[model samples]
Target: MPDFKRGRSFLRGAPAACLILFLAACSGGQPSAPETAAGPTAASTTAAGAPAVPSASGAAPPSSAVPGASSSTRPALSKEAQMETDRLLIRAAKANDPVQVRKLIAAGGDVNAKDDIQDSAFLYAGAEGFNEVLKLTIAAGADVKATNRYGGTALIPASEHGHVETVKILIAAGVPVNHVNNLGWTAMQEAILLNDGGPRQRETVRLLLEAGANPDIRDPQGRTALQNAERLGFTEIAALIRG
Candidate 1:
């Protein structure tokens, strides 16, 4: 973004209106940040689901017998109530407080509700490695397919962090095994990318595979999971993919 004075000079002493337009241009880099405390900045969303807390592998990506009414079917929350619920839900999720999450939901909070950035209780739970809370969200109607602002499903982040049980629960609840985010990476890709392809992530990949996730999906640059694993020296993971 060029400075106003510099832009003005470039425009040969343009009128004051031109300077105002220059200011707008100077601010045109990324999308504007959401005007809510719960919503992280655009910069945050770019890095793997804008995790509230970093998990063992990385800040991650949930599911249950108690099926959640899909987001489309669930009633939308008023902005005020949703904002308040977002505060409690996110707070409890980051803290891994299943009790609090349950209490809030029982008190009329929407399970599939989203914050300003489209993050939900389930999403926060998975990204932070909060298994029990994830279960609570699932039982309370968290959508297995609810996506964040980046179009990455909750499984993508959970896989990225290598949360074995968390990933399993999501898969069991019927989240699409091969769903691609806007970035064109699957949960398998995220799992291998964020780990040393250790046993835990191997298990995550295994669960995804057993759930029928495609192993041959390519990234935006045409890199397959095996190629990524091989390049990263994750022999075990590469072997699993190759087989």
Candidate 2:
């Protein structure tokens, strides 16, 4: 009942002091966690460590967004389109038109495509001594070991025709030198048996011999190349076979 006003003032002052003390404690003792700005999430990053961004359409970016990713595959050709393109290529190759051949090849022509006679561009080019077209086919991935309709490699007919340079190209392209055709004759045998045994034919024989042609490979008549050369009186060719 004594000093009632003084008690009220003291009570008011005590509440203010308590508020100040509480604030001081909160600030001085331990700071509250700071509000941080949001950063890129793991999902927002690309495999290459670049930050991924959404597309204008508000969709996730396509896989092409990644560096070094293939964009898209070329559309496959239809069967009819492929067949027609292959026929055009073969025709251009047979015509020895390098320009057309190159264009056709660039347009996705199959270098190994065969025509009705079972002759591929590669086979015809080699058999006919079309070196320009032959080179084009080889560069376009011609099957060097593919056979013709006669079951002979291009080298067989090439040798029979005395195509010395063509023979060299075929041999260098890894055509089997001693490959015996259905006619049961090696390139060397055909070169001697079919030709006049002239200089080109003799050179063809020499090239075959050097490329490891089997001289002893017999023909249908069971005649070795050496016997054929001698029987045909091809003196230089027989001498080559002797060696």
Candidate 3:
């Protein structure tokens, strides 16, 4: 006959041993910890097929990827293109076309750029009594003391032409009044020698005198302005110089 009591005790111990083995197998022979849910990864996708996660810092995309962003970025112009634009600006200035001049300047034309004759837009405008273009060049930062091909400031030619308003503008802009040109003639001398001593010339001479032009500056012919005036019978100008 079988040992019933012994068999029953063995079956009871079997249940406890089986339970320990099952726990060890599930944990790889170590105690198991609870697992939390994982967060979404960069490559994770949504049901609608869109990106489920943003960038690491969660910032917006680059400007280049946005619409109308390219319009704000202007590439630098090449040297040849800038030179051509500056040439056109000089032409417009010489033609006394303020509209074209403004357009060219807004297109990155240089106001101080010199052409083959060493004449910049600023110099040409002032020398030709183009007050509108001259003011534009001035506001655009033209060098006030810049010289022309004859090494003369704009005031010299303006005075020679009896552009009284232009002379006043140049003087107020701080052009050197006693600046002598390559011909060794100051603005006052050019006004007296080059132009007929009329009402405009007299006014130009008077303006120069008031602006502190030196009457003692002799010409290349070694003649003072006053002596030249007396010889030329500019009695009023000579009288003004005497004062």
Candidate 1: 10-residue stretch with minimal lDDT:
61-70
Q: Rank the candidates by TM-score, best first.
A: 2, 3, 1
Model 3 segments more than 4 A misplaced: 1-76
Clashing pairs in 3: none
Cα deviation of 105, candidate 2, in Å: 0.7
Kindly provide the TM-score of model 3 when superposed on the true structure, using C-alpha atoms: 0.69
| Model 2, backbone clash pairs (residues 3+ apart or across chains), number | 0
Off-target runs (Cα >4 Å) in candidate 1 are 1-83
Compared with the true structure, the alpha-carbon lDDT of candidate 1 equals 0.78
Per-residue alpha-carbon lDDT of candidate 1 for residues 1-243, written as tens digits (9 for 90 to 100): 576565545678678676556656778754444466756675456545743553466734222222443354334556686668767877777777888887887666766777777778888887667888888888877888888887988889889988888888888877887989998899999998877788899888878888888888998889988899888999888888777
Q: On a 0 to 1 TM-score scale, where does candidate 2 land against the true structure? A: 0.70
Score each candidate by Cα lDDT.
Answer: 0.78, 0.85, 0.87
- Give RMSD to native, each candidate: 24.9, 12.3, 12.4
Tens-place lDDT digits, model 2, residues 1-243? 235465556557577666555555645664444444754455757767897787899798776685555343322466797799899989998888989988888877888999999988899999999998998888888899899888899999999999989999999999999888887888898899988999999999999989999999888998899999999999999998887
* Superposed model 2: Cα runs more than 4 Å off: 1-75
Q: Give the CA lDDT, 0 to 100, for residue 79 in model 1.
A: 66
Worst 10 residues of 3 by lDDT: 67-76
lDDT of 3 at 80: 93
CA lDDT for candidate 3? 0.87
